[model samples]
Target: MNNTLTNGLGLLSLVANTGRAHGVTELANMAELPKSHVHRLLQSLVEARYLEKDHQSRYSISVGALRLGRELLRNIPVRRMALPEMMQLVGEVKAALSLAAPFGHEAISIAHITPDGNLRGSMESLGSVLSAHASASGKLFLAYLPEDEVGEVLAQLDYSGGGPNAHRNAESLKAELPQIRARGYSINNLESGANMNSFAVPIHNQDGKVFAALGASAQANELSLKRIAELAPILLESVQRIESTIKEENP
Candidate 1:
């Protein structure tokens, strides 16, 4: 890769990671690139439809970029590959299953499956965003992040959006992350929503980094901490299967 291409890709990554629009000067300052160089790269990206320049001259990732992401996801096979294992886990646990990914400071459900019968908890729909501080899937993501990044994420959380059981401040939440890491999973005991309890374990990619969270949610009355602990092995087993499948497809 040439310097120009490298710099352009870096700038694009910076803008996409910010999850917000930015002006050229701001982007240049953030990227520590020359203003002129940044402007040229931005124009190139806009021309390629990888980014869009707004009326205010601010730039953001465009629909074309999203299309590229969707195309990549379509080929990745995680959703299709993981569905069988998810279904098996859901059947065994008799709870709602979810696959979620970190989206900035939030966790968004990418896929979900509810067990048959009336004993079901409220499940976040696909694309539904939830407080990372309160949800098991979100907390799992947070636990794996660098400490500084976790603090930054916690600073942005709306404690009230989490329920009364959630840690209300970063300090408290930070203290709990170690335990989650040690346990290799996270639990939301009526934290995200009343009577909704969930447990989540990380699904790793080929590099062993957390690629996503695989979780199960049920009514608190139906799933207790002891029960969650008992079912965790099953959840972890499914995660391993998903990870192995991802490795096979990606590698």
Candidate 2:
């Protein structure tokens, strides 16, 4: 890890996540770095077109960054390739479906769909960030991470304000990861919201690493542990198709 490169990327991530402009001093304080060093990194980012400085001398993410993000979303093969299978699964299960990928310490839904007959109160929204310690999709993401990386994300997680069953700290969540991995899936039984239950299975890339998670959610009355067990084969079949598609395209 080159310190200079790491610091520059860290500053970029901070600006992008906050969605607000900040001055050099504020960013320095937030990142816990020297003011002059922060300023130099911010200037370098500006030159690289990742951040823009206004006349007020506050820095914000640039159009260049937006374009890059848009381009990456457009080119994400899984989101495009998984749609047909997702639709099929939705029709079979009549539950909302989501495709999420790991982003930093969270899982972000890149795509979502509601089943026919309009399942009321579906919680997943496009671009929504799921709490990594509470949501099935999020825990699945954490379960597949390298051990040290999981520790880093756990350290940064905010454990406040989840449902009654949500893990309150890193230790409890860490204890559950091995079981999630062993089973090759994860479940959230009212862990993120009232009456919400969900399960997720891993989607691997060509390298056989977890690339994203395929998940389904519904009200607890509608989605029980037994129902999830019955639906697991459907979810895993779609995952197989998605992973096979990725391998065909990338290989």
Candidate 3:
């Protein structure tokens, strides 16, 4: 192996594979790296396409590391074309809408739209994950995920209590899948927090594989089961627009 692979990232594969990025100090401690050596090694890896920096200066595997995935979606037909329509859906709801894409061990809010004046509260809390089980988008995400990955997250769940949907167990969620698929939307009620309701639907790519989930989140005052029912058709229409756009772009 080359020096960069061996001495730099190889010793730190455990941390890299952990999926959570680290800073110089935490990575050094985790990898038993000396303070002096950590910075240089991380710098080298960052330069060599093995690592990337977040806004907070934490390091994680870079997009360059996902070349195979890039190739898979190189012309990622759906995500590319769905932007305008997804934005329009959020506008129609006059609430915060977001799209969460599956990352290795987590999800990323790949798209979100907040108009100049929104009826619901702030959406800044998104783009970061709290619980993969509690949020509507998360449920849609986990529910449709590959079986093994679903097992991994469920296995690591802290069953003690109190999270997005702490009351639910894996089996309960599994049971809900068919309905979510049947209904074409995932609804989460008072699960993320008191007086909140979130709803989501999956976005399928050209090959008919689910690529992301589109969701809307709002305070209880903003969304009632009644309101969600009213909004459902519009949202599904939005999802259709996005899927069609993606295929058009990629093809």
Which candidate has the top score in lDDT? 2
Model 2 residue 233 lDDT score:
86
Among all candidates shown, the one with the greatest TM-score: 2
- Provide the overall lDDT of each model, using Cα atoms, as 2-decimal numbers: 0.84, 0.89, 0.69
Flag regions of model 1 displaced more than 4 Å: 1-76, 117-124
Error (Å) of candidate 3 at residue 187 is 1.5
lDDT per residue as tens, model 1, 1-251: 99999999999888876789999899999989899999999999999999999999999998787676567546645667777787677778988888888888778877778776232223227667767788998888899997668777778777767776998888888889999999999999989887899999998888888868888888999999999999999989878878878888779
In order, how many clashes per candidate? 0, 0, 3
User: Tens-digit lDDT track for model 3 on 1-251?
Assistant: 77555767554574555778778788778777586888888777778777887889888887676653446444544445656676556657877777677765446665566643332222254345535666777667777777667666776664444345543676676677667777887888877786778788888888888878877778878888889889888888888878777778668
lDDT string for model 2 (1-251, tens) is 99999999999989987989999999999999999999999999999899999999999999787666567767888998887788777889889898899887889888888867332222238678899999999999899999878888888899996898999999999999999999889999989997899999999989999989999999999999999999988899889998889999999
Candidate ordering by lDDT (highest first): 2, 1, 3
Worst 10 residues of 1 by lDDT: 117-126
Candidate 3 Cα outliers beyond 4 Å, as residue runs: 1-26, 31-37, 43-79, 115-126, 146-149, 159-165
Cα error, candidate 2, residue 59 (Å): 2.4
TM-score of each: 0.68, 0.76, 0.68
Q: What is the lDDT of residue 205 in candidate 2?
A: 89
Over all chains combined, what TM-score does candidate 3 have?
A: 0.68
